[model samples]
Target: MIGKVPKPGKSFGGCIEYNVLKKDAAVLYADGVRIDKVAHTIDDFNMQRKMNPSLGQAVGHIALSWSPNDKGKLDDEKMVEIAKEYLQKMKIQDTQVLMVRHKDKEHPHLHIVYNRVNNQGKTITDKFQHYNNLKFSKQLTLKYGMYMAKGKEQVNRPQLKGIDKLKYELHDTIKAAIKKVNNITELKKELAKQGIDTYFKFRSGTSEIQGISFGKGKYKFKGSEIDRSLSYSKITQAIQQNVQQRESEQVQHKQFVSDLKAAVQSQTSAFPQRQSTGGKSLLEVLLTPEYIEPMPYIYDTDERKKKRKKAKSDL
Candidate 1:
């Protein structure tokens, strides 16, 4: 494994955001911070900096990544253990910290964001930190031999043959199909086009499913044998998650369109109103109420008043 620490920052908000908010990101461990929401997490880190208010750069960020060869060997628990040790050797202990794993790349990697201000309100010195990182990263790698193995997918593929070739082909095909499909039924349909068939093993004398297998040409293999992530349970969970995510994106899109329309209507006059209004479809004109002209009034003349006026008209 290797460790890279970036320059410290004055604010925790952006640093925390970059680590925790990304595709396939997971929070493996945290200390002295809330994990429920990004806003709360940032607030927790900032609240800690109140101890050493004089420290301009309070955010410490590190990215720990392992070779793709070690991806299978390094689970979250193992990664967290290494991270805590790395922090200790670097003398970055007793600080508010968060560790998050990201699967966006082929190699397994994680991020660590911590406060430079310790619990005792003293600033943690970062002097000679890069040198320390170089030494400790090598030391830790030697201590964990399994992580130093060759990468799993480093072999040449074009020359492969037999069941091994088929297995790798299926692994790649299934992975690609999973992204486009939302469920196993749909995946089966997609794979069928590629001359692959899916079969489910059921419990004896019962409709309950126990396992799954895939077939192509003459050979068949269990889902787990091809790849652990290709197993029935994990695939089903992934499909369900895809469904939920699609629904969420659709809702967000609808809300965005709604908000955009509302904003357009609210501030339509902000732009050139001359053509917007029927007269000047502008905002000011559209917002003003239409004007109405009042009707003229007339009075009726009485006969008795007219006769009195005629008698006095002798003058």
Candidate 2:
């Protein structure tokens, strides 16, 4: 479940009627007001606001939306119970509130309209309400075992409206561009192609960058505003990690090539050294003639006969 606490508006009647009188909208719960009709309920809330005219923003609005995966698990009665619990946790007692369940969307959601002006004529504080709402919503979701939507990655960007859509678009674009970049300068250059201008928030009277923000057209958002992971410190850390990883890989590759060359040189040098020590030199091997044994002596037949005849005649 996620809660969106919009800025409080001045008019309670318009806000109340719109939320309660919508098509297929049912008032699951109403406190300090008549449920007979929408007009009476609006009048009741306005009368309470009149008690404390000093409070400028008399209207408090919160929309609690559940993940689609939590559809059948929550019904109208259970939703009202959860809304009441959420209100109690928010410390919004003694205030006129109306919880309306709308069937306009596929998911289960409730629109809560409450008077920031309490019954005792004291202004109900809205300070840190946005922060508190976020903290409490997550608590409720966890305590009830509701579907937890992963951050911006799972969001349907096209379906998002106004600032939300732009914020997510910036987040997705920046996150993707960050991966391909090696440093902050390169990151800025990459994001510029997508029309996102990166800005650095510097420390007072110093050159150090304290934070970062992105601007697209006229809209600008702090990096953390878009997504917490996109903050300056986180982004810088990721880039530095990439740099270290790349350098490490390069070092390993250089070492591998050096080792391979050394192996080849060792083999080549050893072969020639072995030949020089154990065998003839190249010059001696090339110039020296192979030994030939003397041919066996053979006497000519005529010469042999002549000698034999002479010996016989003398005898």
Candidate 3:
């Protein structure tokens, strides 16, 4: 097992985040902590109360992940023991440590949570401390001789049988088609030509995200499911970027319309009018209140009034 420990630093919004990354080579057992429970406790004591739930700071979070080769051979009890070892190595003595095994994915991992400041009032300083955790984890791996992930070969050759190769190639072909096409119509045609049929669906109260599944020569992809850059930062960043670009274009179009209207209003003139007799307003005679009751009258010149009077008589 290998580990990478990074120093605690300010997060995107200026709040400090203390995190630890551990490669879980030992597949004993796995568990998880309820983040709300942990966050509530941490927030109640470590921060001033606030109405915003996400406003609280993250005291500390530790993630232990490992690639799994055997799904059924995990030791649950040993997994908790290993978690305790990590806490001991981190020198967290008096804090409540929660350990959980997450089985959502193929691999098993342990997520641990502990207070940075111990009950004894001792603060754990960030002193290249992650190195210690990694060192201990490596030592444990060596002691147990757990299944370690092999490093990438220099020649970049994959080890797969003939049937496996065909399955993998088909998977890649479908994946490539999905990436190239924009809308569903084009994607379906492309997949059909490649002897693959796809289905799309959506779920509510979940991620509001989309996903794809391939099985038995059938391909299914949700237009919104696959993330373009999963290897990058949080998924929210990508979503936010797409939304901002759309909003920016909308704002530019609105501004263009506004400028065009302003230009026309500033440069254009109204229709020319004839003078009125008796020094009355030309609009008043043209639109007399008596003729269009309850509306303001438009008095016009004698010539213009004569034309309107003639038109009313014809009507």
Q: On residues 1-315, what C-alpha lDDT tens digit does candidate 2 reach at each position?
A: 877777789987789878888899998888899989778888898899889888888999989999889987899988988888888888888888899989998888899999998989889887766557767888999998998887756665666766667877898899888778899999999999889999999999999999999999988878987777889999999888888988999999789767766665566545454233236543333234663334888889999999999999999
Q: What lDDT tens digits, residue by residue, belong to model 3 across residues 88-114?
A: 776765654445555655665665554
Point out where model 3 deviates above 4 Å: 4-58, 152-315
Q: Which of the predicted structures, 2 or 3, would earn the higher TM-score when compared with the native? A: 2
Give the alpha-carbon lDDT of every model.
0.82, 0.84, 0.48
Q: Name the TM-score of candidate 1.
A: 0.47
**Candidate that scores best on TM-score:** 2
The alpha-carbon root-mean-square deviation between model 2 and the true structure, to one decimal in Å, is 21.4
The digit string of per-residue lDDT tens for model 1 on 78-98 reads: 999999999999999998999
Best by lDDT: 2
Give the TM-score (vs. native) of candidate 3: 0.35
Worst 10 residues of 2 by lDDT: 269-278
Instruction: Work out how many backbone clashes candidate 3 has.
Output: 20
Which pairs clash inside model 1?
269-283, 273-282, 276-281, 277-280, 277-281
